[model samples]
Target: MGRRAALFILFAATALAVMAALSRPGVPQDRALAPGPRGTGPIIVAVLGTSLTKRASWPDRFAGGLSECLGREVQVTRVARANANSRWGLAEAERVAASRPDLVLIEFALADADLTDGVWPGESRSNHRAIIEAIRERRPDVRIVLMTTNPVGGLHRLKRAFLGPYYRVYRDLADELGAGLLDAWPRWPGTASIPDGVHPAPEAEAQIVVSPLLTLVAPGFGAVCG
Candidate 1:
């Protein structure tokens, strides 16, 4: 073959290979898959945490998103209290367990500092461990996913002092509990994504929180584009 012709053929082969790679199964498609059935009975999803989870309106948004994605009926119940610690979260989880939720989204690490009343680090860790144990005991079959709260926007001090540790503890706990982790820390790209710095704006509904949780709950469900 001529030099130019040989080069052209090689380029064409490379392009074909690239296209094949892009077309592989499991590769996320441009179009989102149609949602499944909404559960007949209550598909309870309890979101336990501090004010951020309650005030951010994540539970409502998550229920809507999950329902749309799974095509199943989902009733998300929020058992959250402002500034409550892991201890409080476990108590709420007990109440939620009685309801027999299909899934639980745990968001208690942010309020761990609230329990730090002159206690040693070891004591705090023990308390957290006890809480996780209780949750597992109550809901052995229930799927539990840990949600690490995002850093407070423009508040470097609070982020460093409170959110940083909170994120670490949740990360560790998720691993220990063999639970899924939705670390929202890196998900918030910029201030524009969060209207009030702490709470995500309605526009960020699809990306920051919903998308991650969807992936964890239903990995092979379908594509989710903003």
Candidate 2:
């Protein structure tokens, strides 16, 4: 084959692979695959995220549900910052490590923003990795639970255009790092009762975030008040 033709073919294959690698139309059952500590006693869970972490009552909900399931104490410490990206999480890594949480649940809301040039996913990945490494250095036994952002309805064109790339990064990184994942967007109820499209409705929070967290936190422990 001619050299130009061969190069064209190779470029086409690479492009196709990149497209396939970056697309995540839906989530797989990866949350169940992540490793964590399912010990039989009291535990501390620290939630670090964007506004989603701040707005949702999932931490308290998880505590309540988990306590009921295990018949032991469950404490949730939230270290969330509104409008924050992964960089802030990286900066807060030391403090989070100091908190001595048994598990750190991380969710970065602005990682998918259309405004962050083309490097949002890459930046997010680096920040997340740095934070994870820092925390691990301080607390080798701590487990991390990485969660995907909740859905903004399809009508929200800005997010719909760019969000999947961020999701791709989170999903791939979770697998690569062997960290726990919670792909909460797919199961999220649409923006019905919520005031805005970004934050999930309360029912959606209970269904997607709270329930999955309860399952992960307690491991073998079963259902609780939702």
Q: Pick the candidate with the highest TM-score.
A: 2
Tell me the lDDT of model 1 at 143: 69
> Candidate 2: where is the Cα deviation over 4 Å?
1-24, 33-41, 109-119, 154-156, 220-226
| Span of 10 residues, lowest total lDDT, candidate 2 | 217-226
| Tens digit of per-residue lDDT, candidate 1, span 82-131 | 76666666556568777777777776654564334223335445665665
Task: Specify the highest-lDDT model's number.
Answer: 2
TM-score of 1: 0.67
What CA root-mean-square deviation does each model show from the true structure? 14.6, 6.1
Mark the 10 consecutive residues where model 1 has the least summed lDDT: 24-33
Candidate 1 residue 4 C-alpha distance from true site, Å: 75
Clashing pairs in 1: 36-70, 36-71, 37-71, 37-72, 38-71, 38-72, 38-73, 39-72, 39-73
